[model samples]
Target: MKSELDDQLCRKYPTLYRDRHGDPKSTAMCWGFDCGNGWFPVIDVLSELLSKHNAEVYASQVKKQFGSLHFYYSGRDKYTDGLVSSAQSLSSMLCEICGSQALIQTKYTGWFTTRCKEHTKDYSDKEYVELDVSKVAYLGFGKAWSALVLILIDSCDWRTEHNGMPATHLSITKEAGKLIVSHSGGDDFTYTIRSLHARFQ
Candidate 1:
């Protein structure tokens, strides 16, 4: 997820992310959200419930795996288990890019991701508002996450007010905005992506 959104969750549920400020060797959170921003709502809801139930539970990890959400935790309870399970199931049907309904769940480029059909295409003839985010992909983790960010951005257009149910489609309205997402530590980015020449670290 984007650092801006990630920050909100952490700040809202400090205890749920108690390990976030700990040594990197001790917590995966120091790497920030190790997944895309599409599932922020899922995490947010889960965090809220967990925090409400027990302010001492720690989320060991919240990431994607096998094209679905995987919310690891320290506290064990039927409610927590049920919540995590539901989020995972919901993730399979929601686009990992925009939180809209997904068409399919499959492995892309050897990585598991759920995407809407529009996010998996290449459109060069279109033009829209562009935010040149040559920086921002890297959320200060390192080379590994930088590469992950590149993959996620290929289909991450956050606008949810467009035409399609997913709000983005292979044949979009000529007036619709554009998007480009990239990675580099200490910052985040989104653009009406022209194209990204990924140079992974």
Candidate 2:
């Protein structure tokens, strides 16, 4: 009976190759259905199976490298229109802080980042300091762009837990009652000139 069913499927979708393992009874074991070649139901089943394995492998790799994996069920193949729509949604969501269209979707990784040429140069300048307020502002904005940087600076060096703490790689410059902070690490945090003096005092 199973052989009859397999024969019918093979006849219906001529492109689907038999499973290399020679298991005619196992529909799940079949392969060789190139994109757009297989019947819709067969394609759906194959896509689900492939995606499940791929997701597991990708999640494990991400966890090993980044210490965490933030996977969400996106209901779309990475190469499909669904993925493109999701990317656009994400870009819109971050528009307030990074500005609309500022986030660039990485082609290789499909990840999004707000770091652009101007921002990159700004961060590079943070590593060195001259007396320029504009340079200091550039660094400060970089820090403001990332909350992690603020937490590190506020908790580690600027707070009382460690006194005479070596100044953060970040340095502050005051001009016309505005504070511009720059870091060699490519971050900038700025505050009102008065607020900075008050915090230190």
Candidate 3:
């Protein structure tokens, strides 16, 4: 009778196995014949594997949920004037043209001036127009200058409108203090630093 019952049970669950030496032991090992402690019922083993997979899925969902919550609660507002003001403060301390210690003075509208005497000798009398260094077709400026130039060109509409204007180019001529923009039109408009600000405003 017991042998018939065991055969029927094994047939019902192909993956299930039993040790029938004297005492009966049930197991769900992948290898149907191996009746070791490691063997578990098929459904129980599959449930554990599925549980581990589900844990990973749940973890990822939680991470995305937290990320979205952070964006809604804090990230958006933290980037307001506080961040801009901090960046501007840092910009004032560093030179935007060259990566040197900028001469912080009342001139240049309290912004950090990048034109050293060597660079500004030619345009000493003329106002030094601050052009976006990124658009100027030159490299070798440090990271800060590159970032500043990128921001000015991207954010400032005036700079964007005049970026690729024909006959417009920045030059460091012998007579210029810093780099000045020479626009070749009817009057050969030479934009000095101060004049550039006026035009933008």
Best-fitting candidate, scored by TM-score: 1
- A best-first ranking of the candidates according to their lDDT comes to 1, 2, 3
Residue range 1-201, candidate 2, lDDT tens digits: 134433554454333322323444643234222111112222223333334334431111000001111122223343322222222222221222223222222323443333334333433332322212242344454432232233334533442243443344656555565444555431122122112222321
Full-model lDDT, candidate 3? 0.29
Candidate 2 residue pairs in clash (backbone atoms < 3 Å): 127-184, 139-188, 140-188, 140-189, 143-188
Q: What is candidate 1's local distance difference test score?
A: 0.56
Relative to the true structure, how large is the alpha-carbon lDDT of every model? 0.56, 0.30, 0.29
Worst 10 residues of 2 by lDDT: 59-68
List RMSD in Å for every model shown.
15.9, 21.1, 30.1
For model 2, state the Cα shift of residue 64 in Å: 16
Writing each residue's lDDT as its tens digit, candidate 1 over 38-146 gives: 7777677767766886777898778888888888889877556655665565566556788655534444346557665566444222332222234543344333333
What residue runs in model 2 are displaced by over 4 Å at the alpha carbon? Answer: 1-71, 74-85, 88-96, 103-112, 116-121, 124-201
Q: Candidate 2: deviation at residue 8, Å?
A: 53
lDDT, candidate 3, 88-162, per-residue tens: 332333333342323223343332233433445543454544433556346455544444444333333343366
Q: What RMSD does model 2 have?
A: 21.1
